[model samples]
Target: MSESANDTAQPVTDWEGYSFDTRQVHAGEYPDRNTGLRVPPIAMSAGYVFDDFDDQVDRFAGRSIDPIYSRQGNPTNAVAEERLASLEGGTGSVAVSSGQAAISSALFALAQHGDHIVSTASIYGGTRILFGRSFKRFGIEFDYVWDADDDAEWERAIRPTTKAIFTETIPNPRNDVTDLRRIAEIAARYNLPVVVDNTVGTPALIRPFEHGADIVVHSTTKFLTGHGAAVGGAVVDGGRFDWAAAERAGRAYPLITAAPRPGLGSMLDRFGTGAYARAVREAVVNDIGPSLSPFNGFLLHQGMETLSLRMERHVDSSLSIAAWLEQQPEVESVDYAGLPSNALHGLALRDYDGRTGSVFGVAVRGGIDGARAFVNGLRVFSRMTGIGDTRSMVIHPLSSTHATFPQEINDRLGITPGLLRLSIGLEAVDDLKRDLRAGLDRVAALATPAVSLAG
Candidate 1:
């Protein structure tokens, strides 16, 4: 006789032990107990129903981890948080309204008013602005290490007040990949946590924790969502950094390790290994009020199912496209580490299996005017200011994204007039190539004609 569906309880799946593709699908999903639904249903309600006054007390008092309010936590958002935590090999995760919030909240969770953060100079323009402008106004300081590979430079930048070391795994536009292992080594010596923005190098490409990152942040608006539909961000806690030890060693991360109330002890004392994430979700995110909607959470979760596949296609198309662009007569350079000609190709091969992600920079021969002709003439590649979408998109950083920066700062960061950032999509590689050729042809078409001296 055949076994019945409920005859025996199957062993629980070891999601962490599974491959990336597998974990992306099944990591945080659980069948509905009441309805036996295969997919986890989105809990749209703002607040969960309480059984009694005592039950409410337990939840509101932080004695229970269950959702009390949507802003703090939602059933749907919880699933996303769990899935992201699993994908990043983190112990916990906190979802926020946007990528910027993820960075702000994650950093604020560690660094306070008088604290400092050392970051790579080549980070996203918005992040740089937030650190230099908004965060600076709030009394938090940020220092940058321009040459990220220089281990001594990283060490020299650290001061007694430096609380954390930060950088993007693969800095946007410019493709100089940071040496995570080396930075982590320095952070370890100082008892400081290394926080990495893995937005571009999604877990599909690189898991920062494997290289010693203690916290991982993402703009779920990018590859995590796959489609250009949802906007969200996540902060994943690797649960390895000893915040208590850091505090004891003179690095003051009191935001998560100190008590704000007389009756309440430190998060580290109460939650142990889960303290960082606990503080992020309960204190920082709740206070900041940048909450991810349940709808976006559902959409983001849907996107993760295809992250592995979309990322693979993106890498393949991007590699071919970058190589082709390098040979173009109207092109100056292609800043894709995937190309063997790139200075960072060896790092790409060792780190990301020779794929540095679909986002890269292409400099056209005719400066700003040439770039305008190329982008405006293209049909297939959308002239949009976004990355990690299912449709190829392009943007000029100097005139748009990084236009506010000082000229010297722009030059240092490689946000040149002719440099165009490309976010290659799932479209046919040949189609993308042909569209790019048309753009280049337009640049040539608009060039000044040679003087007819022979005539």
Candidate 2:
């Protein structure tokens, strides 16, 4: 029998203490009291029942079970949040409308207008833009370090005003692994929270909190949904970092440290021990209005059921495809942890379950024109901008995803003009190989000289 979400039931683990496969299926689920249903049902009502004014008062005062508004919290979203948090070993989680919102809200929750943040150079392009353009406009400054793995670089960049160090577990396109343990040591010395976006690896492959990450964010819009049908994001609070320590150190986080406006309680007081995630919920998300809709939450819930199973297949197929692509004469290199030639292979072996994710890039011999020709000629793989779908996705990073970056930054990150990033999927490996072969053949066909008029 399963326990309720509110029940402090001790989690059960396997011989190795809770296998990743088991946790994916059972972590946040509970036996329903009303129906005794094994799976928690979606609560679609916009608001929950409030017995009286006293009940409402109690809930608003942080003393009750009554969830008043969907904006504040929904049963469906709470269930999904709880399950995901359990997977990451976080004390709590907050769901948002999209991945970008998760980042936006978390940053706001951590720092104030004048405070600074230090981040890795190569991350999701949109995140880079958010830090470079938008955050600067709002008076929040950011410093970018070339590699998160370089402890010396990280130490050198840290300043008194620095509030956080942000990076992805496995960076986009490049497939570089940030050495979490090493960076976390640096963050610890400076008393800064290390926030990591674990979207690419997902919880099945890596849990940054275990490696000393204070907070973890996810674009559940990706592998968490698996099918590419939903758009949502989540922020997991490891509850490991002591925000109280920062307060004791005499710094105030607007969301967590300061007293709430007149009537409302300070975020930490209202939310109790899970204040970090709750701050993102009640303050950043509420003010910004990026709540995940109930229907999308339901779609993500459906996707979560088979996450473990799908990830295994996704990893296996990706490894096979990457290995094959590396051998092709037209392909210059493959960036994936599963491949021995990959620069991050050793890191992946130690940190990942010896399994890297499906997203990686291949540099073609002919540069931009050849990449375009190859992608346009392909029939089986979709030339789409998104990733982590059930079907394979292919895109040229230089002309598409990372096109906005300066050439020097692109060169530094290895997003070359000829690079084609592939998000391998559940399709039969042979079929994918044949399609890739056809694409290369098309490039070859275009390069061949036409028969002479004399012939």
Candidate 3:
């Protein structure tokens, strides 16, 4: 026998103790047994084979977690899920078709038709639309707390039927960072789990779980994918919430705590720390059928590999651009928390080290006309509705994202006519500044009065 026969070596599989940078690239990847493929290949099969009759029975009966169908789970999606979970410091995650699917699945797992959710006033406008339109039609109500710091406002918003507290780590457009710790404290008092949207503030910058969120959701289409080539989403379970205690306190999450069938145990008892994610996967995502494609799943995992690196460049460019815009005569104000002059700079410094993500707002001198001129003037920045992409993007939220909402609601949320949301990208900082100056020049032209030559 060869000397090597006496020793056996196994690949490093457990990534729990690895640093974020290392884990991002290696956490969910596994050696392909058949061909020793280093990269995780997209397993596109819709159905999985069972070992025997008993294996199929076990799978359908919930005895085995092996995927029976791709609608429920897939190997490719699993890689993205595990990688996202590892990065977000969660017990488990479920990849879905889109960010809206992730949010709906995540909340649907906890609340039923009659339940309510309290969210901070300043959130993604699309999310607000989802709540007002789809969620409202489903009989699930939402209340917005404008002043998160005011306990009275939270008290007024959160009712007895409230099942979850929803908030974003960094609210879109304005870049107003939520006080997650305060929200967590309020959630703890009511025995409600806090669900945070970390799409804007990716795990590379701020893991909401560390700040006390119980569930984290992401729009993988944005920063996590980096290239903006794929649209996907994921819901990660923080695994620290006390479900039993919450039930005792009169907040019951039936799907997680109740058995699907008489013979089967509750997801909480079966999956333990990963129960919430399991509930989201099996109960909501499986039932709703917003499954992520294997191709997108492959892209999501690959995109995460460079998440931290991209976020660093994104934040650096944003900081430089935001500071520059503040001094521009045509600019009205910059809504970046990283700026010392901003109201949320203290919170940004404490939680995010003053490196808030690249997406923020810049208001020009004139109102709607100024926004129109500024947007039409930009050459480098793509005028689009998406954020967190590798290419810089700009959108007039008042005209696009928040157009359907009432004027008072827009005013309350600070979606001003002159304000333009900017997503700084990986381009050279000087180039981005020059592009922005071009936009500001248009805004300045708007303020200039036309000469009356006839006079």
Query: What is the C-alpha local distance difference test score of each model?
Result: 0.89, 0.83, 0.94
**Model 1, range 1-455, lDDT digits (tens) per residue?**
98899996864445778877888888777768898877889888978899999999988777788778888998788778888999989999999999999999999888778888999899988898889899999899988999866878877889898988999998889877877988898899899999999999999899999999999999999999988899999999999998877878887777677885777777887888788999998889888799999899998988998998999999999999999999999999999988999888888889888989999999998899999999988999999888999999999999888988999999888888899999999999999999999999988876768678885
* Best first by lDDT, ranked: 3, 1, 2
lDDT of 3 by residue, 1-455 (tens): 65585486877779999999999999988889999898989998999989999999999999899999999999999999999999999999999999999999999998988999999999999999999999999999999999988999988888889999999999999999999999999999999999999999999999999999999999999999989999999999999999999999998999999888998999999999999999999889989999999999999999999999999999999999999999999998999999999999999999999998999999998899999999999999999989998899999999899999999999999989999999999999999999999988988887789988995
The residue-by-residue lDDT of candidate 2 on 25-136, one tens digit each, is 6666666778777666877787778898899888876567456688778877877887788788888999999999889888999887888999988798889988988899
Stretches > 4 Å off in candidate 2: 1-18, 32-38, 149-152, 261-273
Instruction: Tell me how many clashing residue pairs each candidate has.
Output: 0, 1, 0
Cand. 3 Cα-lDDT:
0.94
Q: How close is candidate 3 to the true structure, as a TM-score?
A: 0.98
Best by TM-score: 3
On lDDT, the candidate that comes out on top is 3
Off by over 4 Å in 3: 1-8, 452-455
